[model samples]
Every structure is written in C-alpha cells, then in structure tokens.
Target: MVSVSASLAIAATLPARAEDPPPQLTGDWGGWRTELANRGIEFQIGYTEEAAGNASGGQHNYVRAAGQLVLGSTLDLQKLFGVSGATMQITLTNRNGRNLSDDAGLNTLQQVQEVYGRGNIWRLTQFWYEQKAFDGAVALKFGRVTLGEDFAAFSCNFQNLTFCGSTPGNLAGNYWFNWPLSQWGARLKVKSGQVYVQAGAYQVSPRNSDPDRGFYLGWEQTSGALLPVEFGWTPTVGGLPGKYTATLWYDTSHANDVLRNRQGLPLAVYGGDPRREQGRYGVSFQFQQQLTRPDVADPVRGLSAFLNITQTDRRTSQTDNQIAFGLFYTGWLDSRPRDVMAIAIGRTQVNGRYAENQALANFNARGFLQRPEAEYAIEAYYNLNLHSGLDIRPNIQFIRHPGGITNAKDVLVLGVKAIVNL
Candidate 1:
C-alpha cells in the first residue's frame, strides 16, 4: 500500500541535505515549507487506489475498489539538534476497501489487487531512528521497524501481489512482516564500494499484524524473533545500473507442520494435530537491471528487468516457493518520457508435501478438497504519468490454474490504479 520501506531503504543509502525537497501537488506553501526544510523537517503524503473486476472465469464476476493513504515526515537531527548523521521518521497509513480476488471469486494464490489486505483500518506504519557513519557507508536503525523494509526489500510498483513488494514476505508470510506493519527490531547496513551487507532481527509476534494492534507498541504476546542477513551488489555495469542480492533468514518461533501429525504421519489421514516445529528457515534472491537506455544521460528513460525467487521451509509452509520476473519500459515513446509499459509473470508453487497431505485429505473426505500444484499469473499494464504528482495505470491479468487446481477455470481480470503524491 504505502511505501515506508522503500523510503527508508533509499534514506539509508543517501544523506539528507539542507535543501529544497521534491515537488508535491502543493508546492512550497509560500515560505513556510522552505522554513521547515531549513529546520530539517519535511512532510510527505501519498495516496494509492486500485479498482479491479473479473471479466471471465472465477466463481462469480465482481468489481472492487481499495485504497491507501500515507502521511509521514522525516526529521534530520543533524540539522535540527546538531546531532550529526542522525535522522528520524514517522508514518501513518489508512487502508480501506475490499480485495478483488476474494470478492470477485478469483481464488488464486495471489491477489490481483495488491493494495488490499492487512485489514481495512488505520496503522502506525513506521517509527524509527537511524544513524549513519563513516560518510554514509554504515547505517544503523532501531525501534519500531520491519525486516522487509531493509532486507529483501523490493519496489511495490505493480498491481499484482505476485509481482509486488518482498518475495519472501509473499511466500513465508507466516513469519516475515512487510510494509504497513511494524515490530520491535533493529537493522544494520554496511556498504563497501559496490557491495553491501545488511542484517536485522525483528520480533516475530503475530500481534504486529493484528488489526486491533495497529497502534499497540507493547511487546505483549510476543513469539520469538526473526533474523535476516543479506549480501548485495549495486554496480554500474556498462553505464547501466544493476542490483543483485541474496538473503537468508530464520525464525526462532515454533510453527506447526503443514501436513504431518505428531508421529510424522499425514495428519489428513491420521486425523490428529500437526506436529510442531522449533524453527523455520528461508532464502531469497533479487536481480534488477536497466537493460537498455535510449538516452545515456536520462536514467529514467530505459528498459529495466527484474527477477525474484524465494523458497521457504517445506515443513511449515504451504506455498513454499515462488518465482517472478518482469520487464518495464520507460519513455519508449519520445513524446511520453514519463510513461511506462510493463509485463510480469510469476508462479507460486504449493509444497509437494502439502499437496500429498491434500490428496490424502481428499481421499479421506471423498474428494472434498482440491489438490493443488502451482499457480501462475501473467499481468501487463500501461502507466500514464499525466502530471508530476499523478499517475494512472490500466492493467490486465491472466491467472492459470487458480488455487493450483488443474480443473479450475482460468481467470481474466481488468484493473486500474491511480497514485497521487499529495
């Protein structure tokens, strides 16, 4: 919904300056905005909305709309209080409306309307303090935080859940919390030339994502913790920017096996409770590069590609793995330098063990359950940047084997997304 993670990630890599900020719909506000900037305070507001409807397939056809509004501000303590290399950020988000996948009956593994979920309510998205050292090569952040904001973070520029945000959070979401959710945690990032290493430990409590706990800052009902480490390379290859990263993560919390009983037999057949596991582990990779640039000087006008892969522990995960890739062309036409056209394909694979359990359950129940394999999604969109602070994107999606069922009808969906920098 709101991109507090993306903002924090970018802030970690760059130092705040005592200068005018980016343009917004309300420019300057006379001299007040300039006065605030001089005092190291800057405010930002963003709104995103998605509307989608299924044209074919699914259990029924329906249309739904969802939206999010984010309000945030950053304070540079170095300029405000003479505390060098220190900054603070606070953000609040409000999300509302329904999900197309559920309302439209497109029972796919991922949602076509990515902006929905995490309940329709208000949330304290971010509240963190960061300090940079060694000339911006090292950054340490703590307080209310999310692991996805720093490690395995990806741009949420797409409308499909399969192609948006953090891949690990999508696959292993039982433990990994993404944006609009915060937990007690800390993260450290160290950069050396083109290579960087980052690590974080975050609270693994389910309360963080609870709708009622949006403003609850206490550590009550806490589980264990989540630890993640990442290694990355950001290079200018052939004068084109590229980023490659690998992440390894573990959760100390205990989770139940998806399929097995306490005796290690299929719980579906045995009619017993699933076995409890002590820990869970996962790995993920991200690759993004600007493949072609018509104008060497204009970095924004180019063809960029991205690939994401994530694998979770088989013992506790149903959707254990996912692979997604996409390409977006910016300024393909000289007349529309800010326009973008993009297409993406993604597959979410059901864990084989889970599938076996499902088969056993189906056999026991006389084929009441659907045996799943993998769900695939294809999405394409054209983004019209009508002005500096507004963009409208029209998109289409094709979902194959919804819920990974071979007999299920493929779904076709149409959608539109609007974004405003308020």
Candidate 2:
C-alpha cells in the first residue's frame, strides 16, 4: 500500500499542476479508475513505441522499432483496512523490438530510446510494501524493489537515455540497474521540512538480470549487496520549485578489472589473463530547477533545466565519468499547452587504463594508434500532445566518436516516439 505522502513525493517534481483534469483515457473507464483510486486501489497501464535510425556516418544505416508495455497497481492499506500507514505497489513490464544503436553499430553509451532492453519479454518489475511512521516523518519499504523508484528520481521526458532516470545507470550499469529491474532490497528514509535523507541495501547478483528469471526470487546465487545513500533538498527559486540530490553507492561484490591482469599488466600483454578486485563504488549528483512558472492563462507553460553527473571506479569500469545537461520547455504554443520541447548533451569519458589496454591490443595485433578517450552526443526533441492520453515525439541526435572508438565514424540519428496512456 502506497501512502499519500509517498504519492505526493513522487509527483512533486512533475510539471503538471494539481488542478489539472484527469486523463481522458482514464475517464473513459466510466470514472472507475478515479473511483478505485479514491478507494485505495490504483491501476496503471501504459505503452510506448520508438522508431530510430542512423541516417549518416555510421558502420551501417538501419532503422529499428522498439516497444514496451507497463502495467502497475498501488494499494493503500490505511484507507482500505485501517492498517495505519501501510502501502503496497506491484508492477509488470513487457519489452520487445530491436535497438537502432545495435543495428547500426553506433556503440554509444547512451541508448537512443528509453524502452530498449536486452530481450523481448514480460517480467515482474516491482512488488514493494511501505510503512510510514512518526507523523509521516519516517518511512520504510522492502521487497522486490528498484533503486530508481526512490533514489535520484528523475523524469524521462527526453528520448536519449543520458537524460533518463539515474545517472548511475550510465556509469555503473553492472551494479545499478534502473527501472523495470527489481531486486530483493529495503530502504529507509527520514524527511524534515524540505530535506530528506535515505539509504538502501539491495541484493547484487547477475542472476537477477536474467530475463528468464522473471518473478524468480532466489538468494543462493547472490554475490553481495549494494548500499546506497542519498541526500535531497527541495527549494524554491524565484517562486518556482526545484530539487537537488546527491547520492553515493558502494558494492561489496568482487569485480574483474577491465584491462589489467593479476600482475597489474595489460591483459593484452598477459596473454588475456584476468584480474579481479573487490569493493566498487560511485557517486552521482542531480539538479532539476524550474526557471519559469506558468500563469492562469497557460497553466502548463513553464521551463526547467537539469544536470546529471556521475563518476565511477576507473579500475573496473570502462566509462569512468559521465555528465549531461538539458533544458525542457512546456507549452511551446499557447494552443498546445501540453506540448514540450527539449535538448540535451552528454559526454562519457573512457577509462584511461582501459583505453591504454585497447591501444596495446591494437598495436600488438596490427599497427600503432592513439587511444580513444571519450564519446559525445547531442539530442533534441519536440513532443506533440496529440490527445489527453497520447504523445508523439520527433527527435534527432548527433554522435561524435561513437563507442569512444576512433574507428567509428561520427553519426546522425533520427527517431520518433509514441506513448499511450490507459
């Protein structure tokens, strides 16, 4: 059961006003969705589709279509059965289709679309129980949970994965899986005024990512645990609201070095031997601020900017650091108050040691060449509010040094996305 405070906390950063009308698609249920929500049971269903392709300067030119479906529900125990401050949530996700980056050999760190994944399959994403205490000042949640649901939360208004939820996903994907992937975990948070501090302990096991293990909960193969702590501050700027968050994470599992052998020599020079180390860690910062507020005549008109940055342990990760900045403008036109436009740029720095290893490999195998250092991408999009429950977005992206490899040519990608709410 999700508490009222929990719901409000999640919606705090959204640009939508509280007085906005309910979605028309939900109203089509004969007011059943609203009625159910008022009675402590809330249902959610949504579908998103993306078509993307690299039009120029890649290993190849190809287009791909991807789609995802999400179904979820939340229950408030306090309202339904007088259970004090208890809440529960359940969610399932289904993903299918091909990835444009893979098809076109872009080899970029950021995905073109947020819906792309490893496979086309249905999986249980979240089933968590939360309890609040001390006049809603403290809360506890546990079960199959996702890190993104509570920590460093951000909206996915852009098509580029770089601007999506959680900066750690780009810096530490091995240990910090984002939404649509849940693991056994628990989180505790305490709120005081506009500030909150939270910490979580999550299971770290590669088996949890196996699509075939959907809904499976087994601890026998667990390698270790990931501990994350976050501090958040909410403030008002020029009468507009904003949120700033900083998070740190440490994983207790053993991680293999990407480039070095046991003797600290490059793997290419050590006949491909491996070296393993323990204790991986990373840090991330996120800031989202509304620069302008909407007026009575344009309730949905506003502008906001966001920045995300992350740094990971260089010894075990190919990408040592990543930074992204973006701006979002809603109600670009007076007639289309729900429409949005945005642009963003991101850079992923290749780990120096890993680049040296690759350079050594290339020199030994063929000839001499300078090592790759980083990859950069810029993306822009316009979202059209076709209907109350539907949005269509057209996007373009420019990639320089795809995959952080010099051999990969600069590329331009075009894409479109459609989302349906039910």
Candidate 3:
C-alpha cells in the first residue's frame, strides 16, 4: 500500500544522478501541480488492487479481491517555514476486502494476496517529520511511522507475501509492523560516502493491530519497544547501482514460548499457560544489483536480481527463518520498453519446537496429523505498463505444503494486480 511512498524515500537516501520526473495520471493539474511542488507542498494519491483465484489444490476453489487507497502530502519545511533541511509527511490509507488464503481454505503460511490484510478500515499510516544536517549526511526522523518504511525494506513487485515487503516483518510480524501500520517511533541515520548506518526504536503492542484502533494514538497498551540497527553500502558496480545491507533487531516485549509451559513441560500435554520469554530478536540481510543493461545511459531498463534472508527468534516464532531470491528484467520487449517480467522462489521454515508441539497435540487426540516442516513458494509475473502512470500485472503462484503442513496439498493460484498513480 505504501510501496510508492517507500520507494520515494529509499531513492532520496541513496546517491543518484538527476533524472526526469516520475509519471502521473493527472497531467501537472494544468501546471498547478508543479506550482505547488515549487511552493514546498505536493499532494499524492495512489491506489492498488489485487484479485486472485485458487485454480486447484485448495480446500475450495474461490476468488477474492482487496485494495488500498492512500491520500497524502509532503511539506518541504525549508521552503514552507524557512527551516533548512526539514520536511514532513502525512498519509492516510483506506483498505478493504478479503484474503483468499483463509477464505478459500488454502491456509498458506504466506498470503497469496499480499495486500489483503491489516484490517479493512481507515488508518492514519504516517505522520513523521525528518531533519537533515551535515550537508545531507545525517538524518533524524520521529513521530508516527512504520518500521519497514526505512528498515529491512524491499520492493513489492511480487503479489505473493513471501517475496514482498520486509522479510523481518514477514517472520516476526507480531512486533515488526510493516507498511500501512504505524506506531510511535524515531530513527537516526548517518551516511558517509557510499556506506551508511542507522538505528531506530518503535512502540510495540497488540493494540496497534486492532482494527478499531486505526486512528488511536494513545500509549495505554504499549507492551514495550522494538530496537533495530542496520549497516548499508550502496555502490556502483560495472557502472550500475547496487545496494547491500545487514540488520539486527530486538523487541523488548514478553512473548510466549512455542512448546513448553512455565515449568518446562510440554504445553500441549500439560494444558497450562505457556512460558513467557524475556524478548525476541532477529537478523537479516538484503542484496540487490543490476546485472546487465543494453543501454548504459538508461537506468530504468536492465536485468536486476535481489536476495533476502531473515532469521527470527525460534522460541516465539512459528516460522523461524526464510530465504527468498528473485530476478526482474525491465524493458525486455522492444515493443513494450516499460514492461517488466519477474520470477521468485522462497521457503519459510516452521520452528522445530512448534512442530513438536503440534505432534504432541496430535498424539493426545489419538489422531494422525502431519507435522509442519516448511512451505515453499514460487511466482512469476509480467507487468504490463498500460499507461505512463498505470500498470497491470498478471501472475501465477505455486505453493507446496501450505501452512508448512507436510501432507497438505499443493496450491496453484492465478492473480492480477493493478497500480495507479494519481
């Protein structure tokens, strides 16, 4: 939902050559758009929709649709109030519709419709202010914000949840809130040359995920805080840009154990309160590079590859870790220079302790149950650039062992995604 905004922020942080303006459906609002931008105020509107159908292997074949609409604006404080190096952003989102993974009985660990969660309601997604100093080498931002907007973030080109957005959020979503979900937070970043380091802290609590709490900003139910640190390197390789990053994160909230009770006995068998762990932690790495380009001066047309790996606290996480890799080729067709073709594969591993707990539950019930080990996902899509500010992507997805259940039937899904910039 925040893909467009997140991309803008990411591009601003990295060094790049000046380029032409991004396309928009509305043509400069008859020159008023450019005038507002020149005056330090720019408005933004984006809409994204996803429709998916389970063609086979799910409990029942069905189709579902979900969409998000974002309304926002950016204020360049340097021009608006004569405060150099200051800027502010405010965004509100409206999300609605159903998730096929659950409604169609797929029960997949990763969603087939990536955009179909976090409640169907209105939300104040972002309200943050940032200041830069040292000739743009240092930046500090605070207020209501989402962690994945600036940490462990990745492109959302794929419709499958496994290969979209932040890996840590995919694994440890209980604490690591992703896009469309904002919490009180602050971040500090310092960049020197091609290397940069950043750290942040964000409020964590179950209240933040409540549908009715979309616009609630009180700190009454905050459990603790999430801390994350990242180091990154952006370099020009073979005259092409590449980014590599590593991050470590810890959540200062008590989480329940996956297998045992407070006295160290099997919770499934003993039937008591599960043990509460002190905290949760994880580490992740991201790599992306442009492999080749027919036209050296055309930065938009190239073959790019990305890899994301993340490991979370096994004691509290159902899925302990994941590894995903993908390749996207832009301008592969001479007739459709703006089109993109991409494919990705990913594996999500269930925590061993959680698997054991499931086994115990099955044994106690005297019923046969397949122990979950891992789930694998594969996807490919051809993005059709129908217009300068609109894109339609039709994709196919395959899932093996839905929900990591070893004996679960594999699933095949057909999907399409539409993106519009207004």
Candidate 4:
C-alpha cells in the first residue's frame, strides 16, 4: 500500500506528455530522453599521527589513512531504458591497524603494533540499477545501494575516535566506501517531500576463519517537525539553509555471508559473534544550521553546525548497550577553496569495560560507533575513579583534562591523518 501511494505521488510529478525514449544498450531511465548529460569524479586525501610524551610504560603514537572517490551522472535513465536504468560506481579504503599500548600499558613500537597486522581493504562502494517512475514521485534502486535512512548523509562520522569510524556510515556507513559498512543485499525506499521510508535485506558479515549465514531486515521514518539531533528545533532556512530533522531506523537479521565477492573472491562477513543470530537497531536525532551568506561571506564563508545522538538495542547477549552524541562544525578560513577544517566529538559507553575484560570473560568482544574509546571522556561520565581509574585507547589518547589512569603525558595525538579518492 505504501509503495503504491509513493508510486502515485511520483507519477503526479512527472510530465504526462509522450516523452522521447532513452538510449539503448546503456539501460537509461529518466530525464535522458529530453534532458541528459552529466558525469564527474571526486577525491579526498588525508594524513594524521599522534605521540604522547609519557604513559604507564612509554609513549604512544597512532597513524591512519582514509580516502574516497565518486563518479556521478546527470543523464536520466527512464527515457533511455524501457525498464531499469544503469549507473556504475566503485569505492575503497586502504588502512592499517595498530595497537595502542602493549600489555605493560607502556610504549610500544610501531613495528610491534599491527594495524590489522597483516590486513588489507578494498570495498566496491556503489554499483547498482535505478528506475524512476513516470511521475518522478517514486524511484527504485537495486544492486549495492545506499539506504539513505535519514541524516546519515550528514551525521555518523568521527575521525577523532577510531570507534566512530564504522566502515564510515551505516544507512550502513557514511563515507562513500569503507568496511563493516552496508551489506550486499536488495533494498527499496520511498521519499515524499519531508517524509521518507525504507526496507532492506542484507548478508551479514562474519568473524575469523569461520563464517555464518546471517541476513538483515528493517524499516525507518523521518519528519521535519522536530530535530532530534541537536536537542531543539531548527529549520533549513532560505537565509542560511539550516534546519532540524528527526529520524528513526530499525534493523534485524537472521542471516550471514558465506564468504565471496560478486567475482567469487573471498569476502568477509557482515556482523555476528557469540550469538548465531545477529541483531542491531538504533534511533537517531539531529539538527543543523549553516551560518553564511551566498553572494559574499567570510573566508569561513559557510559554517555548518550539527549534532546527533543514537541508542542501540541488540539481540545478542554479548552485544553491549550503546548510545552516541556527536557535535561538529566545518568551514574554511576566508572561504579558501582548498582550505577546510572540521572538529567533531562523540561519546559512547558499552556495558563491558576493557579494564574489566578479566571479569567479562571475552576481552576480544568487538566495539562499534563510540565504543568506549576513553573512560571519563569530556561529554559522557564526569569525575574520574582514581581507584579503578579510566582507560584510553590508541584513538582517545588526546582529548581532556587528564584524570583517568595517569598524567597528561599519556594522552597526546600528533601526526598525519589522511584520505584519497582514487
């Protein structure tokens, strides 16, 4: 019924005139018959490194790599193809994993640390088929596609925290391409003005040499009445393009990946651990405001401020309760074209603790988005328990008034943080 309603809405928008057909062999969908011609590429490169002066044993240092690439087309597919349209895309991230401190909680050499140790990455960001309704009110997308759940296009990123970068986004990840991101499956979505909805099924990721048969299913909704992200109401203003948005997403899976990419090459599983059935669902709220003028503005001509919070409930007993709050701002000085900078902060707390790994039983229990990067962080819990103290991972080595486990010397990040779109 909802699909039918969306189709009607889309049909209402498209021109009823008998439009010229689209190109053949290319599998074109819409706009192409009368108007079509668009293509482009995008890229990003970054570098970062950090070293603490002192620690429980020695100093700490962390290095990372991040990058992306985007190829877009303006040609409509419907006008070209009688059925589905075609668009091609690809994305990848090459990263190395490193351990913060050795068992002694002291300085560990980079050589001794293994960022994924002997691991590598290559994600096929996007490659799918799309079809637009004659009315332009509804569109159908198949193949590896982004489920644009809500503010995922804006929120769900935290370069500062290692945990915050889950494959990148999740409507399954934010960045164009990354790991533990969206699964390979079929998805359907609907959009009508300010309201949106979605349904999807995915082959879940697995662990180690063993694998599981896991899959996903879910739905979501969003409205402009209240911006849950920022704790208040804001509207995207014609004056500033700032507005508030509220979003809700839920997903459940009872399947897993057997291992293999489209080409039959071995690919990693999606998500599942102690529990045979993997379940993950969360809700988010956000608000954004762009402070700047179009014609004339400061070097920092445009400033966008946004915040989001999400909580998760999982069916797996090993899975920890999760909640995340993020605050961020981005812009450039004097509106310099290539000169841009951003600061983002997030806080997350899990049921199990690294320090309590002994009591918890499973220390290797994986962590996700805001996974307790640092104890006694700036936003979450206040006051430090000097007795039990707090723990700082490789990523959270820098933020704070130094109260957790040791002196300020132990938390300092300095180095190159980079990404490239190729």
After TM-score superposition, the amount by which residue 158's alpha carbon in candidate 2 deviates from its true location, in angstroms, is 1.6
Query: In order, what is each prediction's RMSD in angstroms?
Result: 3.0, 3.3, 2.5, 14.8
Candidate 4 residue-wise lDDT, 117-152, digit = tens? 213343333445555554544645555433332123
The reply for model 1, stretches above 4 Å from the true place, is 1-23
In candidate 1 the C-alpha lDDT for residue 415 amounts to 93
lDDT of 1 at 311: 94
The top-ranked prediction according to lDDT is: 3
Q: Predict model 2's lDDT versus the native.
A: 0.78
Q: Write the per-residue lDDT of candidate 1 for residues 174-271, one digit (tens) a residue.
A: 67888788888998989999999999889988888897667879877787989999999989988877889999998998899998889988899886
TM-score quality measure for candidate 2: 0.93
Compute each candidate's TM-score over C-alphas.
0.95, 0.93, 0.96, 0.51
lDDT-sorted candidate list, best first = 3, 1, 2, 4
lDDT of all the models against the reference? 0.82, 0.78, 0.85, 0.31
- Cand. 4 TM to true fold: 0.51
Pick by TM-score: which candidate is best? Answer: 3
Two-way lDDT contest, 1 vs 3, winner = 3
For 132-216, candidate 2 gives per-residue lDDT tens digits of: 9999899999999877767766666666787776678767877787777789999999999999999999999877788677777
Q: By TM-score, how accurate is candidate 3?
A: 0.96
> What lDDT score goes with residue 308 in model 2?
87
Worst lDDT 10-window in candidate 4: 1-10
